[model samples]
Structures are given as structure tokens and as C-alpha cells.
Target: MYTEKVIDHFLNPRNVGIIPDADGIGQYGDPSCGDFLRVYIKVKDGRLVDVKFLIQGCPAAIATSSIMTELAIGKTIDEALKITDDDILEAIGVLPEEKTHCSNLGAGALHLAIEDYLENRKDN
Candidate 1:
């Protein structure tokens, strides 16, 4: 079962697009599972000025990806990096135990995006 927040997010999916000039990009998916996620971030002055995501997955996956972007935007890089699966679960209000993977994927994808940002910054 999904919560109202989850359903709302699923239907209205936030930040569902791409950043053409993204400062950072991260992707995660399981070929066997058929769920793919890509998160794009625009950073400025060590803060995540914007965040967006493109997801091809289930309801939970879509909702989590949507929620993750909302949570990341306007956060400092360090603050966004600390976002966790539990935080998403709490925000969404509910997710069946079996679908917990969706939340984990959201958190992991965000972290990976941050990692990519930091790495890219290091190189530049």
C-alpha cells in the first residue's frame, strides 16, 4: 500500500526532466529489475541550487525519485549528501516493506549524484 503523499507524488511526479547543462549526473538501475533512475543536479557556491530526475520504474520508484529531488534542492552539498532512505520513507509517509527498495534507490541515486558533482568539481 502507498500513502497519500506517495500517490500524490506518483501522479504529479516532481522534477521529472533533465538538466541540459547539469553540473552533476548520476544513474542507477538493475537491468533484470527494469528500474532505471537518473538524477541531475545544478550546484552553485557549494549548494544544490536545483535538482531533477528522470525515472523509468514502478510507482514507488517514481514517487521516491520525485520526492528526492524536492528534498535535495536548496540544500548544501553536505546536507543533501546526508539524506537517507529513512528520511524519504518518513517523507512519503508509507511504503510496503517489499517496496522499501524504492526509497533506498532514491537515496542512493542522490548520493551518487553528489559524488559525481564532487568528483567533477575536483577535476575542474
Candidate 2:
């Protein structure tokens, strides 16, 4: 039901916690799928110096969230925004068709986090 990469990430998820002083935070969930993903970002000089997640979901959701951080960290905000669901699927290598929606949780959250960061920055 899971690929080697998927199993590995699920078993030992990366960026698996929160950033207490995060510069930006975003969450995404599909109630029907019972997956909820929250992402946090720390930016410096317009680069994503750090990224983290707190996830309540299946193995696929956890794996996607974990992999998303690995792909996004160190990227500039513009670059991060360019990360798409296909990018995530390719990074993970493959995913079950039924679980594909899990792939979006990470990208969606990252996008929202960046948006939140940008919006708040504009306010001040």
C-alpha cells in the first residue's frame, strides 16, 4: 500500500515538529480524508531558512508533509510557491491513487504559509 520512500518517510518523518517563533504558519485539511497538515516557516533574507510541520493524518499525509519541507527549505519564497503537487509526487516517487489528495496537503500548506507571511509583512 506504500512505496519504500513513502514507508521510510512515514516511519521517520522529517521536519516533524513546530517552530515556536515561526515567521509564518499555515494549515490545510480534508475533513473527508481525515488529514490535517500545519506548516511553519522561518524566512531570512527572503529565503526559507527553515520549515516544519505538525500533521495529523495517514502515512501518505505524513510522508508528503515531511517531503515537502525537505523540498522547500532553503528556497526563496518565489521558488517555494512554485513547488507543485507533481513536484511532491515526483519527489516521493509514487503514491497510491486513492491517497493522491494527501500530496496537496503539503504544497497547499506551504503556499498558505508563504501567503500569510507576505500578507502580515505587508500589514506592517
Highest lDDT model number: 2
Q: Rate the local accuracy (lDDT) of all candidates.
A: 0.89, 0.93
The RMSD of every model to the true structure, in order and in angstroms, is 1.1, 1.3
What is the alpha-carbon lDDT for the whole of candidate 2?
0.93
Error of 1 at 80 (Å): 0.5
Residue 54 in model 2: shift from native, Å? 0.6
Q: Candidate 2: misplaced stretches above 4 Å? A: 30-33
Model 1: per-residue lDDT, tens digit, 1-124? 7788999999999888999999988888874777889889999998998899988899999998898888899999999999999998888877888888888778888889889989998998
1-124 per-residue lDDT for model 2 (tens digits): 8999999999999988889999899989965668999999999999999999998899999998899999999999999999999999999978889999889999999999999999989999
